[model samples]
Target: MPRFAANLSMMYTEHDFLDRFAAAAKDGFQAVEYLFPYDHPAAEIRKRLDDNGLTQALFNAPPGDWGAGERGIAALPGRETEFRTEFAKALEYAAVLGNDRVHVMAGIVPADADHARCRSIYLENLAYASASAASHGITVLIEPINTRDMPGYFLNRQDEGQTICRQVGAANLKVQFDCYHCQIVEGDIAKKLERDFAGIGHIQIAGVPERHEPDIGELNYPYLFDVIDRLGYTGWIGCEYRPRGGTSEGLGWIKPWLKR
Candidate 1:
């Protein structure tokens, strides 16, 4: 069976951020993930995780100016300095939180921007991040987000993400395979999972059309879970989705998996 990590950023909205750790543990989640941990001190977050007996599965490095709508700066030219500083902060949090995976978001591409230049910058930044994170036993991740939700986002296809991962040529650099985004951009989900299994470092799932619970959508999560199991994947699958109703109330879909 696949291990599921409750996404604190999208799930458990009813509880305070710190309290969500206990809430997830109570509901039988052994691990948890979130977007960023900059708001609270690393010690505080670590305390919550240790207290709740939960493992920190994954989290994103600081995207540039999240409040101002800047997603990430790794792909943007001339922002290497900021990216390095922010990534260092992320690594610090990862050290305290005990998570090996750190996702690096590729920023939005301007309508008239030079595609080649952006790719060059992205490759260079990823190489830098991979090398820095390697010393701490952390893996850097790049996710291919769908254009529908994140218009103009630089990375969008599974092949593109994997190809970039190869080009970067860093063993610690891998792609974050998000099923919701993949379903939106490309339909051949199972085949893609099988073909790109080697380069994938982490996975996330949500409903199609609406980013809700895995069982609430058109895709048959059970089948996909079987496929994942058949492929011998042992990583945590992040429940990165919004709840249509209460977070815990809508967790019926995952209860069966949690038992294992």
Candidate 2:
């Protein structure tokens, strides 16, 4: 059976980190993942991880000011220095949190920015981070956000994500397999999983149309889970979705999968 983890960022705020941590543990999750850890003190986060006996399976690198029109700089040219500083900051937090993976958030690039240039910058940044984080036993993950939901994002396709991972040529670099985004952009979830399982470092799920629980949508999670089981994945599958009601209330649909 695969371990399950809740992504607290989508379900809880920075103020509710501890509360959610305890909740996830009580609810029977073996671990937890989140978007970013910059808001809380690294030591405090580490302490909580120990307190609840929850593993920090995944966390995201710095995504620049979303309010300032910058989502990330991993694929931007002028933001190379910005990416380094932000990544280093994320690395510090990841080390303290004992997180195994640092997901690279693919931000939106301006319409005028050259795609080749963006790819170049991203590769450079990946090379730099891969070398630095490898010493600490951390893998850098690349997530492809669906363009329909995240317009102008640099990487949106599984193929493109794989391409970038290869271009970086770092053993530490891998793709975050987000079921929600991939279902929206490309529907062959099982085939893609089979084809790229080796390069996929993490997985997340949310129902299509509502971004709610799997039982409430078009995706047949029972079959999906079976496929995952057959693939023999040992990593955690993050419940990264919005609840129709209270976070705990929305978890009823996934109670069965949690058993596995």
Candidate 3:
């Protein structure tokens, strides 16, 4: 039915992390995603979800050196140990929330880290993560972030992500397609989704240019949602946009879509 989701992290300074979910609940959202929940125990996060009947849609793997601008280390050499450890921690939280997928965040590529080397490291880690998550029935997702937002970031396109998913060769390893990023890095989001739908395990969104409410922006979400609905896409459509104010103030933009 093309269920919608709000990403908790996008609330940023506009709303308290938890208040976003609460407002989302009131705004008729029943699912949500988070970039990182490692700081919050799985038990408490799950309690929030249970208390509000909100399904925890997805969360990113532990981000390394985030303050220094490092997002992930999944593709770094000799860091398989760090990747796996953080991935395990992510799985622990996923289990607690019964989340179906966890995004295996790809880190920046060092000046010396070539595609062959980074691809090898990323796929190797994916193979390990896919197998581990399979036992828990949780899929591991790899999202392609735009280089504009992430300089030197690895896995910035659908083709690359899909190819690595093939290399990983595990049922649990799939693409975490973000429409916002793809629209920025590679346009024609619907066409790309059609081409790589099989590898896609999840979806996220934000308006282009201005990452605000869906209606106040360039992306025609109704059309996007319609296409996804017709294509039998069952994954959560995560709203990972920057709000103009507290969630409620700017959320009236999506009021039309809130109807259940």
Best of the candidates, TM-score: 1
TM, every model: 0.99, 0.95, 0.94
Summarize candidate 1's per-residue lDDT along 1-260 as a digit string, tens digits: 99999999999989999999999999999999999999999999999999999999999999999898889999999999999999999999999999999999999989999989999999999999999999999999999999999999999999999999999999999999999999999978999999999999999999998999888767889999999999999999999999999998999998788776
Location of the lowest summed lDDT over 10 successive residues in candidate 2: 10-19
Position 154, candidate 3: lDDT: 89
Clashing residue pairs found in predicted model 3? none
Pairing residues by index, what is the TM-score of model 2? 0.95
Better of 1 and 2 by lDDT: 1
Please rank every candidate by TM-score, starting with the best: 1, 2, 3
Q: What's the lDDT for residue 101 in model 2?
A: 92
Q: Cα miss at 212, model 3 (Å)?
A: 1.9
Rank order by lDDT, top first?
1, 2, 3
Residue 7 lDDT, candidate 2, scale 0-100: 85
Task: State model 1's lDDT.
Answer: 0.95
Instruction: Estimate, for each residue in 50-114, the C-alpha lDDT of model 3 and write its tens digit.
Output: 88889988988887888888888888887888888988998888889888888888899877767
Score candidate 1 by TM-score against the native. 0.99
Q: What value does the lDDT take at residue 196 in candidate 3?
A: 90
The runs of at least 3 residues in candidate 3 whose Cα sits more than 4 Å from the true structure, single-residue gaps closed, are none
Error of 2 at 254 (Å): 2.4
**Looking at model 3, which ten-residue stretch has the lowest summed lDDT?**
11-20
Give lDDT per model, in order.
0.95, 0.85, 0.83
